[model samples]
Target: MTPEPNQLLRPSLYVGALVLPLLMSTSALAQSAGGDWSYKIAPYFWGTGLSGTVATSPALPPADVDASFGDIWDNLDFAAMVVGHANNGRFGFSGDLQYFKLGNSGPTPGPAYSSVDVAITNKIYSLNAEYLLKTSSTSEVWGSIGARYWSVDAGLNFSAGTSPAASARSKNTWVDPMIGVRGRTELSGDLYLVGWAYAGGFGVGSDSSFDLFGALGYQFTPTTSGIIGYRWLSVDREDGSFQYDVEMEGLMAGVSFNF
Candidate 1:
């Protein structure tokens, strides 16, 4: 028997809520011990562009209608993460817990009116591991992999004068496998430049997607640093009325502390 949609999403929420706290606690303990553990907390912001296709089938009397390139606009993106790294000045390992939110609103074609207002929101949580491939007195390179939990909700609300006067909403969840690379190079005594890119996919349902990012940072001390960056993320839904595609590129700044 197939599980209900809510049934599937509920478990993901529960698991994320339970695991996030545990990871945070473990990271804290490692920090107090002065082990090869370090943590970074940062807030990120992005501007977004969105577009999608909506299909209405004949069974619904729409005769297989298609809505293309629905709408595009700039969006405010927000994200925060707690990351821990263990680097013995050479071989290294890292883990991260991250949360992100993206939202946008715009005008879309309506049945009998010029357009209707639509809004979309996306929330994601990720846990990942990294390995350093190379480290020098001024630069270091690393690769990473992990699991991502994602949730998206989208809706359309018609104007008061639009025909049929309607609204629709949808939600989906997925577990994606992710991989990426990162590097850092010193620019001064207490400052460094940083950059990274990550991509992932969910093979089942409408969860397939990819994300890429790049950033630069400044070290305030031996164990603390601040960074700024940009990212682009996209996801495709295999079975739905809508095909999802979004591009987010903007400013992100955050801090990291190593123990």
Candidate 2:
């Protein structure tokens, strides 16, 4: 006999309730064990370029208009993240919140003939259930899958000389599935090396697009680590055309704490 619709929903609801509390309790226990939370912070600098129809606009003037445009366009791309982990011997879990920002001066010679600046920012939060494949007194490897919530905003500013400026902004948000793998190796008694790669996608305002990032970290203690790394991101715009693409490449640094 087939199960009723209500029965099917009940089982999933029960499973979610059980799993969520168990994960929460485990994390709380880790925090009390000298495995308390820790944090890391890093900032990077980079350059960006625009392509497609947006790049080909006739409003922008020539590229060599001002030195300030060159400097602003090439500088200040960075990402920041904070993460927390909880683990028993063989299994553990982690959650992270991250932010990234990129900006550049649009090429001159567009229809406006005024200098235009573009800035894009992304914010993401994720929770993952992890399984430790292997762990020794000195090293560990793990993999995970979970859910992610993300928000992105893009803004454009137009300015002429030192006068007033005008701007436009667009924003989007979505939830997606996420997965990752991470590993750590002891370099010495108090020092360790760590690395990870995470991939995910969101469907909002456009067809689902994915993001992938890799990072490296150095452990200061069993519960705390400092990290520095790079991320490359590509997104399909909501414009419904092949002519618009949003891409980002930059450096990132952050910290993680295990509880």
Candidate 3:
């Protein structure tokens, strides 16, 4: 169902101000390039703020939305994300999964209503196939093609509601085709630089979508490392009269395991 766009909270996607490096060390992945297969997994946290315009139906004009990192933190009910990568020879693949829930409550006049509550949940997934375009003992560059999927659910409920004052819910889902390139190189012993960018949509699903990332990684052991960086992501979509333009920017941190 589509509901009126009401300055809904937006989580934006990943990517940010500093070309956020990452917890997943691509340099480590580069070091593993060979005839044998290698794998890595990592979990990430993004302290993000979001801004944009949204409309459930063109019947109503789009509304501006601005959500600060602090506001999101206060209403966030849950969040989780995991990324995995595997490669053999010059070919490989990667997958990412993320989920988040946000909620808000407001008091209302008595008599018929007491309070109103709003809840929003989001789920996202991406899968990509990769091919090495350049490689060295300490660095590598890859070309990739992928698909991303998104699902959003929003609902509102009122307490002590009278006749016709019920609850409402809205849900939306879509997929986008993407292409991008990423690479990493050792800066010095045990330290590396990484970055990647991708674009999609093109009217297939959304009108347009983009993601950017960069980071520095530190390897503490053969199988363990960590990273910190900034990231930014944005997407524009329209379904019938519904349209949404969303942008997310934030800081990122995470740990990775290579094997």
Candidate 4:
């Protein structure tokens, strides 16, 4: 069933209400330096575990997964991730790209099949426009509005033993609206911290979603830093024959290069 219009409008309106004050403050702090933008690029790694229920095909029932990074690594095919940021005075923009693939094979419980093979892949992209809320020599905070695009594919093949071999595959994609805050501060000489939290969806796109990350960094040089962090992400949505309600969390490591 389609959602009521009001269900969608309410969250957007709420986001607007909260952002109004931030806009006012940003205007007060707006500077004339439009051409003096700074940029940074961070390539990151997340060793994550996925836990929850998922249904990729209408012909299959939802399955509960509690796969650890180790479990996934056993069958991992490829993975890549990077984040980029650009700032001009009090205004900023950020983007992230991440993708990974996994394949596994195991014995089946039922006598009809001798074994089961599975393949899964995920791709995510995020973009945000932000305004600096407060800034100082040692610390800075920003408010942001963003969107995340998610695409997932899953496939399974059953080996014939007592029954005929069969295969099923499915793919789905969606985008979610997000709003949140992010910041960083110096802890001591050559040491610093960074993180961000965001919540969105509100039935406008998916049902709901949330993302959070925190990290500690060591400055290697004026233009480079190495960071270790933890990240938690959750997304829930079921449209038509597709369902993906899952949470992912684990260790994160990265290097940030400023330019």
Using TM-score, give the best candidate's number.
4
| Highest lDDT against the true fold, candidate | 4
Q: Which digits, one per residue and each the tens of the lDDT, describe model 2 over residues 1-259?
A: 1235674454345434544565567556666775433322222222323332222223332232122323534533544455556666666667665655555565545444467776666676678888988878887888988887767666667776544555656666667676778777777555556667766654433344455555556777776667666555555544421112555555555555443
Of 1 and 2, which scores higher on TM-score?
1
How do the residues 1-43 of candidate 3 rate in per-residue lDDT, one tens digit apiece? 2222332223323422111233245545666654577878877
Estimated TM-score for each candidate: 0.69, 0.59, 0.72, 0.77
Ordered list by lDDT, greatest first: 4, 3, 1, 2
Q: How do the residues 79-166 of candidate 1 rate in per-residue lDDT, one tens digit apiece?
A: 3444545544344455555444334434444355334444555666666667778878888888888777767665655544445555
Mind sharing the TM-score for model 2? Answer: 0.59
Q: For model 4, how does the per-residue alpha-carbon lDDT over 162-259 read when each residue is reduced to its tens digit?
A: 88887778888889898999999999889999999999888977799999999999999999999999988888889887777877777789899997
- Candidate 2's displacement at residue 58, Å, is 16
Model 1's C-alpha root-mean-square deviation from the true structure amounts to: 8.0
- Colliding residue pairs in candidate 1: none
* TM-score preference between candidates 2 and 3, better one: 3
Regions of candidate 2 where Cα sits further than 4 Å from its true position: 1-79, 108-115, 136-138, 158-167, 188-191, 202-217, 237-245
Ranking by TM-score: 4, 3, 1, 2
